[model samples]
Target: MTSPYAQQGFRVGFDWGPAGAAAVPGSIVAVVDVLSFTTAVTVAVDLGIDVYPYRWRDETAVAYAEQLDAVLAVGRSQEGITLSPASIRQAQGVRRLVLPSPNGSTISQQLSDSGSTVLAVSLRNTSAAADWVAARLTADPSLTVVAIAAGERWTDGSLRPAVEDLWGAGAFVAGLADRGVGPLSPEARAAAAAYREVAGELPEVLHECAGGRELAAYGFAGDVVVAAEVDISGLVPVLQGSRLSESSKPSRFCPVT
Candidate 1:
Protein backbone atom coordinates (compact mmCIF):
# COMPACT_ATOMS: atom_id res chain seq x y z
CA MET A 1 0.00 0.00 0.00
CA THR A 2 1.20 3.53 -0.79
CA SER A 3 1.46 5.30 2.49
CA PRO A 4 -0.45 8.61 2.42
CA TYR A 5 2.64 10.54 3.52
CA ALA A 6 4.80 8.63 1.08
CA GLN A 7 2.59 9.72 -1.80
CA GLN A 8 3.37 13.37 -1.00
CA GLY A 9 0.35 14.06 -3.38
CA PHE A 10 2.53 16.27 -5.54
CA ARG A 11 5.80 15.88 -7.31
CA VAL A 12 5.11 19.12 -9.18
CA GLY A 13 2.78 21.17 -7.01
CA PHE A 14 1.61 24.75 -6.45
CA ASP A 15 0.86 26.49 -3.19
CA TRP A 16 0.59 30.00 -1.74
CA GLY A 17 3.00 30.99 1.04
CA PRO A 18 5.66 29.60 3.35
CA ALA A 19 3.16 27.30 5.03
CA GLY A 20 1.96 26.08 1.67
CA ALA A 21 5.54 25.54 0.61
CA ALA A 22 6.20 23.50 3.73
CA ALA A 23 3.18 21.34 3.06
CA VAL A 24 4.42 20.35 -0.38
CA PRO A 25 7.53 18.20 -0.31
CA GLY A 26 9.98 18.68 -3.12
CA SER A 27 13.71 18.68 -3.66
CA ILE A 28 13.43 22.02 -5.44
CA VAL A 29 11.27 25.07 -4.74
CA ALA A 30 10.30 27.99 -6.93
CA VAL A 31 8.96 31.24 -5.51
CA VAL A 32 6.69 33.43 -7.63
CA ASP A 33 5.90 37.08 -7.00
CA VAL A 34 4.70 38.56 -10.23
CA LEU A 35 3.37 41.98 -9.20
CA SER A 36 6.73 42.87 -7.71
CA PHE A 37 9.67 41.18 -6.00
CA THR A 38 10.32 38.37 -8.47
CA THR A 39 9.52 40.72 -11.33
CA ALA A 40 12.06 43.20 -10.02
CA VAL A 41 14.61 40.44 -9.57
CA THR A 42 14.13 39.19 -13.10
CA VAL A 43 14.62 42.72 -14.42
CA ALA A 44 17.69 43.26 -12.28
CA VAL A 45 19.25 39.93 -13.24
CA ASP A 46 18.61 40.63 -16.89
CA LEU A 47 20.59 43.80 -16.36
CA GLY A 48 23.41 41.76 -14.76
CA ILE A 49 22.79 42.69 -11.13
CA ASP A 50 22.64 40.23 -8.27
CA VAL A 51 19.65 40.41 -5.96
CA TYR A 52 19.15 39.61 -2.28
CA PRO A 53 15.72 38.98 -0.80
CA TYR A 54 15.01 40.78 2.44
CA ARG A 55 11.71 40.57 4.29
CA TRP A 56 11.69 44.21 5.38
CA ARG A 57 13.23 47.51 4.34
CA ASP A 58 14.42 48.12 7.87
CA GLU A 59 17.79 48.43 9.55
CA THR A 60 18.34 44.70 9.29
CA ALA A 61 18.11 44.96 5.54
CA VAL A 62 20.37 47.98 5.56
CA ALA A 63 22.94 46.15 7.63
CA TYR A 64 22.65 43.08 5.44
CA ALA A 65 23.18 45.17 2.32
CA GLU A 66 26.24 46.67 3.90
CA GLN A 67 27.45 43.21 4.71
CA LEU A 68 26.90 42.02 1.15
CA ASP A 69 28.06 45.32 -0.38
CA ALA A 70 24.72 45.52 -2.19
CA VAL A 71 22.40 48.41 -2.88
CA LEU A 72 19.13 48.43 -0.96
CA ALA A 73 15.97 49.18 -2.91
CA VAL A 74 13.82 51.99 -1.61
CA GLY A 75 10.13 52.64 -2.27
CA ARG A 76 8.74 51.38 -5.56
CA SER A 77 8.42 55.01 -6.68
CA GLN A 78 11.45 56.53 -5.03
CA GLU A 79 14.13 58.19 -7.11
CA GLY A 80 17.10 55.85 -6.66
CA ILE A 81 17.36 52.07 -6.45
CA THR A 82 13.68 51.55 -5.74
CA LEU A 83 11.80 48.29 -6.22
CA SER A 84 10.43 49.49 -9.54
CA PRO A 85 11.39 47.21 -12.44
CA ALA A 86 12.08 50.28 -14.56
CA SER A 87 14.53 51.64 -12.02
CA ILE A 88 16.39 48.37 -11.67
CA ARG A 89 16.55 48.00 -15.44
CA GLN A 90 17.83 51.56 -15.89
CA ALA A 91 20.21 51.73 -12.97
CA GLN A 92 23.93 51.37 -13.74
CA GLY A 93 27.14 50.97 -11.78
CA VAL A 94 25.42 48.59 -9.38
CA ARG A 95 26.36 44.94 -9.26
CA ARG A 96 24.20 43.80 -6.35
CA LEU A 97 20.80 44.76 -4.92
CA VAL A 98 18.85 43.78 -1.82
CA LEU A 99 15.12 43.87 -2.54
CA PRO A 100 12.66 43.76 0.32
CA SER A 101 9.07 42.55 0.08
CA PRO A 102 6.56 41.15 2.54
CA ASN A 103 5.47 38.23 0.38
CA GLY A 104 8.05 37.14 -2.16
CA SER A 105 11.12 38.02 -0.18
CA THR A 106 9.80 36.38 2.96
CA ILE A 107 9.10 33.18 1.04
CA SER A 108 12.49 33.34 -0.66
CA GLN A 109 14.24 33.72 2.68
CA GLN A 110 12.27 30.86 4.14
CA LEU A 111 12.95 28.54 1.21
CA SER A 112 16.60 29.49 1.11
CA ASP A 113 16.92 28.45 4.72
CA SER A 114 14.97 25.27 4.09
CA GLY A 115 17.94 23.73 2.23
CA SER A 116 15.92 22.98 -0.91
CA THR A 117 17.02 24.13 -4.32
CA VAL A 118 15.38 27.55 -4.68
CA LEU A 119 14.57 29.47 -7.85
CA ALA A 120 12.76 32.78 -8.30
CA VAL A 121 10.22 33.01 -11.10
CA SER A 122 8.16 35.77 -12.67
CA LEU A 123 6.20 36.23 -15.87
CA ARG A 124 9.23 37.75 -17.51
CA ASN A 125 11.26 34.52 -17.32
CA THR A 126 8.66 31.82 -16.95
CA SER A 127 9.76 29.68 -19.88
CA ALA A 128 13.43 29.95 -19.07
CA ALA A 129 12.89 29.11 -15.43
CA ALA A 130 10.73 26.10 -16.20
CA ASP A 131 13.04 24.80 -18.87
CA TRP A 132 15.96 25.05 -16.52
CA VAL A 133 14.21 22.98 -13.89
CA ALA A 134 12.92 20.49 -16.41
CA ALA A 135 16.39 19.87 -17.77
CA ARG A 136 17.59 19.02 -14.30
CA LEU A 137 14.69 16.69 -13.66
CA THR A 138 15.26 14.94 -16.97
CA ALA A 139 18.88 14.49 -16.10
CA ASP A 140 18.19 12.95 -12.70
CA PRO A 141 14.53 11.87 -12.75
CA SER A 142 14.59 11.71 -8.98
CA LEU A 143 14.00 15.33 -8.11
CA THR A 144 10.61 16.87 -7.48
CA VAL A 145 9.69 20.56 -7.71
CA VAL A 146 7.16 22.72 -5.93
CA ALA A 147 6.26 26.15 -7.15
CA ILE A 148 5.04 28.42 -4.36
CA ALA A 149 3.21 31.60 -5.23
CA ALA A 150 3.97 34.30 -2.73
CA GLY A 151 0.41 35.50 -2.46
CA GLU A 152 -0.17 39.01 -1.23
CA ARG A 153 -1.83 39.92 2.05
CA TRP A 154 -4.90 42.02 2.64
CA THR A 155 -4.73 45.30 4.50
CA ASP A 156 -6.16 43.57 7.57
CA GLY A 157 -3.68 40.67 7.13
CA SER A 158 -5.33 37.88 5.19
CA LEU A 159 -4.22 35.79 2.24
CA ARG A 160 -5.04 37.66 -0.94
CA PRO A 161 -4.62 35.42 -3.96
CA ALA A 162 -3.20 37.47 -6.77
CA VAL A 163 -4.18 36.36 -10.25
CA GLU A 164 -0.95 37.60 -11.77
CA ASP A 165 1.07 35.23 -9.62
CA LEU A 166 -1.26 32.39 -10.41
CA TRP A 167 -0.62 33.05 -14.07
CA GLY A 168 3.11 33.18 -13.54
CA ALA A 169 3.18 29.90 -11.68
CA GLY A 170 0.73 28.30 -14.03
CA ALA A 171 2.94 29.19 -16.97
CA PHE A 172 5.80 27.50 -15.18
CA VAL A 173 3.87 24.30 -14.61
CA ALA A 174 2.78 24.36 -18.23
CA GLY A 175 6.37 24.72 -19.35
CA LEU A 176 7.32 21.62 -17.41
CA ALA A 177 4.42 19.80 -19.00
CA ASP A 178 5.65 20.84 -22.42
CA ARG A 179 8.94 19.19 -21.53
CA GLY A 180 7.15 15.89 -20.76
CA VAL A 181 8.23 15.86 -17.14
CA GLY A 182 5.59 13.86 -15.35
CA PRO A 183 2.26 12.61 -14.30
CA LEU A 184 1.77 15.98 -12.60
CA SER A 185 0.00 16.20 -9.31
CA PRO A 186 -3.54 17.55 -9.30
CA GLU A 187 -2.45 20.97 -8.09
CA ALA A 188 0.13 21.23 -10.84
CA ARG A 189 -2.38 20.13 -13.46
CA ALA A 190 -4.81 22.85 -12.39
CA ALA A 191 -2.11 25.51 -12.52
CA ALA A 192 -1.12 24.51 -16.02
CA ALA A 193 -4.78 24.60 -17.05
CA ALA A 194 -5.08 28.11 -15.62
CA TYR A 195 -2.07 29.22 -17.62
CA ARG A 196 -3.41 27.80 -20.87
CA GLU A 197 -6.73 29.54 -20.26
CA VAL A 198 -5.09 32.97 -19.93
CA ALA A 199 -1.94 32.54 -22.00
CA GLY A 200 -3.27 34.65 -24.87
CA GLU A 201 -4.85 37.33 -22.67
CA LEU A 202 -2.12 37.72 -20.06
CA PRO A 203 -1.60 41.45 -20.34
CA GLU A 204 -5.27 42.38 -20.29
CA VAL A 205 -5.99 39.94 -17.50
CA LEU A 206 -3.15 41.35 -15.43
CA HIS A 207 -4.22 44.90 -16.14
CA GLU A 208 -7.74 44.19 -14.99
CA CYS A 209 -6.85 42.04 -12.00
CA ALA A 210 -7.26 43.51 -8.54
CA GLY A 211 -3.53 43.83 -7.90
CA GLY A 212 -3.00 45.31 -11.35
CA ARG A 213 -5.69 47.90 -10.89
CA GLU A 214 -4.42 48.71 -7.42
CA LEU A 215 -0.92 49.30 -8.72
CA ALA A 216 -2.27 51.28 -11.64
CA ALA A 217 -4.31 53.46 -9.30
CA TYR A 218 -1.10 54.04 -7.41
CA GLY A 219 0.52 55.05 -10.73
CA PHE A 220 2.58 51.87 -11.04
CA ALA A 221 0.76 50.17 -13.86
CA GLY A 222 3.93 49.95 -15.91
CA ASP A 223 5.22 47.53 -13.33
CA VAL A 224 2.18 45.36 -13.90
CA VAL A 225 2.76 45.47 -17.65
CA VAL A 226 6.36 44.47 -17.20
CA ALA A 227 5.33 41.63 -14.93
CA ALA A 228 2.91 40.34 -17.55
CA GLU A 229 5.48 39.96 -20.28
CA VAL A 230 6.21 36.26 -20.88
CA ASP A 231 9.64 34.89 -21.83
CA ILE A 232 11.14 38.17 -23.06
CA SER A 233 13.95 37.60 -20.57
CA GLY A 234 16.53 34.82 -20.53
CA LEU A 235 17.54 35.27 -16.92
CA VAL A 236 16.87 32.55 -14.35
CA PRO A 237 17.63 33.62 -10.80
CA VAL A 238 18.80 30.94 -8.37
CA LEU A 239 18.89 31.61 -4.66
CA GLN A 240 22.18 30.77 -3.01
CA GLY A 241 22.35 31.86 0.57
CA SER A 242 20.38 35.07 0.99
CA ARG A 243 21.23 36.44 -2.45
CA LEU A 244 19.85 35.62 -5.90
CA SER A 245 21.99 35.47 -9.03
CA GLU A 246 21.63 34.43 -12.63
CA SER A 247 22.01 30.66 -12.71
CA SER A 248 23.99 30.38 -15.94
CA LYS A 249 21.53 28.22 -17.91
CA PRO A 250 21.60 25.67 -15.12
CA SER A 251 18.75 26.89 -12.91
CA ARG A 252 14.90 26.85 -12.61
CA PHE A 253 11.27 28.61 -11.99
CA CYS A 254 6.83 27.72 -10.79
CA PRO A 255 3.00 27.49 -8.72
CA VAL A 256 -0.24 28.73 -7.14
CA THR A 257 -4.08 29.00 -7.46
Candidate 2:
Protein backbone atom coordinates (compact mmCIF):
# COMPACT_ATOMS: atom_id res chain seq x y z
CA MET A 1 0.00 0.00 0.00
CA THR A 2 1.59 3.25 -1.07
CA SER A 3 1.19 6.19 1.27
CA PRO A 4 -0.77 9.18 -0.03
CA TYR A 5 2.06 11.51 0.94
CA ALA A 6 4.54 9.75 -1.31
CA GLN A 7 1.89 9.22 -3.98
CA GLN A 8 1.51 12.96 -4.18
CA GLY A 9 5.20 13.29 -4.91
CA PHE A 10 5.68 14.74 -1.49
CA ARG A 11 9.39 14.19 -1.18
CA VAL A 12 9.16 17.68 0.32
CA GLY A 13 6.60 18.92 2.86
CA PHE A 14 5.84 22.07 4.89
CA ASP A 15 3.73 22.72 7.94
CA TRP A 16 3.73 24.77 11.16
CA GLY A 17 4.01 24.12 14.95
CA PRO A 18 5.35 21.15 16.88
CA ALA A 19 2.24 19.13 16.15
CA GLY A 20 2.64 19.74 12.46
CA ALA A 21 6.28 18.86 12.83
CA ALA A 22 5.46 15.59 14.54
CA ALA A 23 3.22 14.67 11.61
CA VAL A 24 6.00 15.17 9.07
CA PRO A 25 7.35 11.85 7.78
CA GLY A 26 10.41 13.17 5.99
CA SER A 27 13.82 11.73 6.81
CA ILE A 28 15.42 15.18 6.62
CA VAL A 29 13.85 17.80 8.87
CA ALA A 30 14.53 21.52 8.69
CA VAL A 31 13.20 23.65 11.52
CA VAL A 32 12.37 27.29 10.75
CA ASP A 33 11.96 29.94 13.42
CA VAL A 34 12.29 33.30 11.73
CA LEU A 35 11.31 35.47 14.67
CA SER A 36 14.47 34.47 16.57
CA PHE A 37 15.85 31.14 17.64
CA THR A 38 17.08 29.72 14.36
CA THR A 39 17.86 33.22 13.13
CA ALA A 40 20.19 33.76 16.07
CA VAL A 41 21.74 30.37 15.43
CA THR A 42 22.45 31.34 11.82
CA VAL A 43 24.20 34.52 12.94
CA ALA A 44 26.16 32.79 15.68
CA VAL A 45 27.19 29.93 13.39
CA ASP A 46 28.27 32.40 10.73
CA LEU A 47 30.48 34.05 13.37
CA GLY A 48 32.09 30.63 14.05
CA ILE A 49 30.15 29.89 17.22
CA ASP A 50 28.49 26.58 17.91
CA VAL A 51 24.88 26.76 19.14
CA TYR A 52 23.42 24.30 21.60
CA PRO A 53 19.67 24.07 21.33
CA TYR A 54 17.76 23.74 24.59
CA ARG A 55 13.99 23.61 24.97
CA TRP A 56 13.76 26.12 27.81
CA ARG A 57 15.60 28.64 29.92
CA ASP A 58 15.73 26.53 33.04
CA GLU A 59 18.32 25.01 35.33
CA THR A 60 18.98 22.31 32.73
CA ALA A 61 20.08 24.90 30.20
CA VAL A 62 22.41 26.56 32.69
CA ALA A 63 23.85 23.20 33.67
CA TYR A 64 24.20 22.18 30.06
CA ALA A 65 26.08 25.36 29.25
CA GLU A 66 28.27 24.84 32.29
CA GLN A 67 29.00 21.28 31.25
CA LEU A 68 29.93 22.40 27.77
CA ASP A 69 31.80 25.46 28.99
CA ALA A 70 29.62 27.65 26.79
CA VAL A 71 27.77 30.85 27.60
CA LEU A 72 24.04 30.64 28.17
CA ALA A 73 22.08 33.24 26.29
CA VAL A 74 19.42 35.16 28.19
CA GLY A 75 16.23 36.87 27.14
CA ARG A 76 16.21 40.18 25.29
CA SER A 77 15.94 42.23 28.49
CA GLN A 78 18.77 40.51 30.32
CA GLU A 79 22.30 41.93 30.59
CA GLY A 80 23.93 39.70 27.99
CA ILE A 81 22.96 38.59 24.54
CA THR A 82 19.56 36.99 24.13
CA LEU A 83 17.85 35.24 21.21
CA SER A 84 17.95 38.44 19.23
CA PRO A 85 20.07 38.05 16.12
CA ALA A 86 21.10 41.70 16.22
CA SER A 87 22.67 41.20 19.65
CA ILE A 88 24.35 37.97 18.57
CA ARG A 89 25.72 39.70 15.49
CA GLN A 90 27.44 42.22 17.76
CA ALA A 91 28.50 39.76 20.46
CA GLN A 92 32.21 38.87 20.84
CA GLY A 93 34.48 36.34 22.55
CA VAL A 94 31.86 33.66 22.44
CA ARG A 95 33.03 30.34 21.13
CA ARG A 96 29.90 28.39 21.90
CA LEU A 97 26.40 29.71 22.65
CA VAL A 98 23.63 27.80 24.38
CA LEU A 99 20.38 29.30 23.10
CA PRO A 100 17.04 28.32 24.59
CA SER A 101 13.75 28.95 22.88
CA PRO A 102 10.25 27.55 23.23
CA ASN A 103 9.79 26.76 19.54
CA GLY A 104 12.92 26.17 17.45
CA SER A 105 15.01 24.71 20.23
CA THR A 106 12.17 22.49 21.36
CA ILE A 107 11.72 21.18 17.83
CA SER A 108 15.45 20.67 17.50
CA GLN A 109 15.68 18.81 20.81
CA GLN A 110 12.60 16.70 20.05
CA LEU A 111 13.86 15.66 16.63
CA SER A 112 17.41 14.96 17.81
CA ASP A 113 16.73 11.29 18.52
CA SER A 114 14.28 10.73 15.69
CA GLY A 115 17.12 9.42 13.50
CA SER A 116 16.43 12.08 10.88
CA THR A 117 19.11 14.41 9.56
CA VAL A 118 17.95 17.63 11.26
CA LEU A 119 18.79 21.04 9.82
CA ALA A 120 18.30 24.50 11.31
CA VAL A 121 17.15 27.29 9.04
CA SER A 122 15.91 30.90 8.90
CA LEU A 123 15.52 33.51 6.18
CA ARG A 124 19.14 34.53 6.67
CA ASN A 125 20.27 31.34 4.96
CA THR A 126 17.13 30.15 3.19
CA SER A 127 18.71 29.72 -0.24
CA ALA A 128 21.82 28.09 1.14
CA ALA A 129 19.72 25.74 3.23
CA ALA A 130 17.74 24.77 0.15
CA ASP A 131 20.94 23.99 -1.68
CA TRP A 132 22.22 21.92 1.24
CA VAL A 133 19.02 19.89 1.46
CA ALA A 134 18.96 19.44 -2.31
CA ALA A 135 22.41 17.93 -2.19
CA ARG A 136 21.27 15.47 0.45
CA LEU A 137 18.22 14.46 -1.53
CA THR A 138 20.32 14.17 -4.65
CA ALA A 139 22.73 11.82 -2.93
CA ASP A 140 19.98 9.65 -1.49
CA PRO A 141 16.87 9.75 -3.62
CA SER A 142 15.10 7.60 -1.08
CA LEU A 143 15.16 10.38 1.52
CA THR A 144 12.44 13.00 1.76
CA VAL A 145 12.67 16.52 3.24
CA VAL A 146 10.32 18.38 5.53
CA ALA A 147 10.54 22.09 6.33
CA ILE A 148 8.86 22.72 9.70
CA ALA A 149 7.96 26.25 10.69
CA ALA A 150 8.30 26.61 14.45
CA GLY A 151 5.44 29.05 14.87
CA GLU A 152 5.09 31.31 17.88
CA ARG A 153 2.89 30.73 20.91
CA TRP A 154 -0.26 32.71 21.29
CA THR A 155 -1.55 34.25 24.54
CA ASP A 156 -3.56 31.09 25.23
CA GLY A 157 -0.49 28.95 24.48
CA SER A 158 -1.88 27.85 21.14
CA LEU A 159 0.34 27.82 18.09
CA ARG A 160 0.27 30.95 15.98
CA PRO A 161 1.23 30.18 12.38
CA ALA A 162 3.78 32.88 11.83
CA VAL A 163 4.00 34.51 8.42
CA GLU A 164 7.74 34.96 8.63
CA ASP A 165 8.33 31.29 9.24
CA LEU A 166 5.89 30.43 6.49
CA TRP A 167 7.84 32.67 4.19
CA GLY A 168 11.10 31.17 5.30
CA ALA A 169 9.92 27.62 4.77
CA GLY A 170 8.23 28.55 1.52
CA ALA A 171 11.43 30.05 0.24
CA PHE A 172 13.17 26.73 0.78
CA VAL A 173 10.35 24.82 -0.86
CA ALA A 174 10.49 27.14 -3.86
CA GLY A 175 14.25 27.00 -4.06
CA LEU A 176 14.21 23.21 -3.99
CA ALA A 177 11.65 23.04 -6.75
CA ASP A 178 13.72 25.46 -8.79
CA ARG A 179 16.73 23.19 -8.45
CA GLY A 180 14.71 20.26 -9.86
CA VAL A 181 15.42 18.22 -6.77
CA GLY A 182 12.15 16.31 -7.11
CA PRO A 183 8.42 16.60 -7.10
CA LEU A 184 6.85 18.60 -4.25
CA SER A 185 3.74 17.86 -2.23
CA PRO A 186 0.71 20.12 -2.17
CA GLU A 187 1.77 21.44 1.21
CA ALA A 188 5.19 22.30 -0.15
CA ARG A 189 3.66 23.79 -3.23
CA ALA A 190 1.46 26.13 -1.19
CA ALA A 191 4.42 27.27 0.87
CA ALA A 192 6.36 28.01 -2.29
CA ALA A 193 3.43 29.97 -3.64
CA ALA A 194 3.17 31.93 -0.42
CA TYR A 195 6.87 32.74 -0.56
CA ARG A 196 6.69 33.86 -4.18
CA GLU A 197 3.75 36.06 -3.31
CA VAL A 198 5.85 38.08 -0.88
CA ALA A 199 9.44 37.56 -1.94
CA GLY A 200 9.72 41.08 -3.31
CA GLU A 201 8.44 42.69 -0.12
CA LEU A 202 10.12 40.52 2.49
CA PRO A 203 11.46 43.24 4.77
CA GLU A 204 8.20 45.15 4.78
CA VAL A 205 6.19 41.96 5.13
CA LEU A 206 8.31 40.94 8.08
CA HIS A 207 7.72 44.30 9.64
CA GLU A 208 3.96 43.84 9.28
CA CYS A 209 3.44 40.24 10.36
CA ALA A 210 2.05 39.54 13.84
CA GLY A 211 5.34 38.13 15.08
CA GLY A 212 7.24 40.90 13.37
CA ARG A 213 4.98 43.56 14.92
CA GLU A 214 5.43 42.07 18.37
CA LEU A 215 9.19 42.11 18.05
CA ALA A 216 9.07 45.62 16.70
CA ALA A 217 6.88 46.80 19.57
CA TYR A 218 9.42 45.26 21.91
CA GLY A 219 12.13 47.38 20.17
CA PHE A 220 13.78 44.49 18.41
CA ALA A 221 12.68 45.48 14.92
CA GLY A 222 16.23 45.24 13.70
CA ASP A 223 16.11 41.54 14.46
CA VAL A 224 13.25 41.24 12.02
CA VAL A 225 15.43 42.90 9.42
CA VAL A 226 18.16 40.42 10.13
CA ALA A 227 15.69 37.62 9.65
CA ALA A 228 14.41 39.15 6.45
CA GLU A 229 17.81 39.17 4.78
CA VAL A 230 17.75 36.19 2.39
CA ASP A 231 20.90 34.42 1.16
CA ILE A 232 23.17 36.76 3.14
CA SER A 233 25.00 33.67 4.38
CA GLY A 234 26.19 30.51 2.73
CA LEU A 235 26.60 28.59 5.96
CA VAL A 236 24.23 25.77 6.78
CA PRO A 237 23.61 24.79 10.42
CA VAL A 238 23.27 21.04 10.88
CA LEU A 239 22.20 19.18 14.00
CA GLN A 240 24.51 16.47 15.27
CA GLY A 241 23.30 15.09 18.60
CA SER A 242 21.77 18.11 20.41
CA ARG A 243 23.96 20.87 19.04
CA LEU A 244 23.86 22.91 15.81
CA SER A 245 27.15 23.61 14.13
CA GLU A 246 28.33 24.87 10.77
CA SER A 247 28.13 22.18 8.12
CA SER A 248 31.66 20.92 7.39
CA LYS A 249 30.80 21.01 3.71
CA PRO A 250 27.79 22.92 2.42
CA SER A 251 28.00 21.66 -1.14
CA ARG A 252 27.55 17.96 -0.43
CA PHE A 253 25.37 15.77 1.70
CA CYS A 254 27.08 14.14 4.65
CA PRO A 255 24.63 11.47 5.65
CA VAL A 256 24.68 9.95 9.11
CA THR A 257 25.05 6.24 8.79
RMSD of each: 4.7, 3.6
Residue 148 in candidate 2, Cα distance off native in Å: 0.2
Task: Give stretches of model 2 more than 4 Å off.
Answer: 1-9, 249-257
Highest TM-score scorer: 2
lDDT string for model 1 (81-185, tens) is 887787777798998788899999888887776778899899999899888999898888779898888889988988898888888898999999898877688
**Pairs of colliding residues, candidate 2:** none
In order of appearance, the predictions have TM-scores of 0.92, 0.93
> Best by lDDT, which number?
2
Candidate 2 per-residue lDDT, tens place, 31-127, comes to 9999898899999999988888888899988888888788899989987889999999888899778899999998998888888888888888988
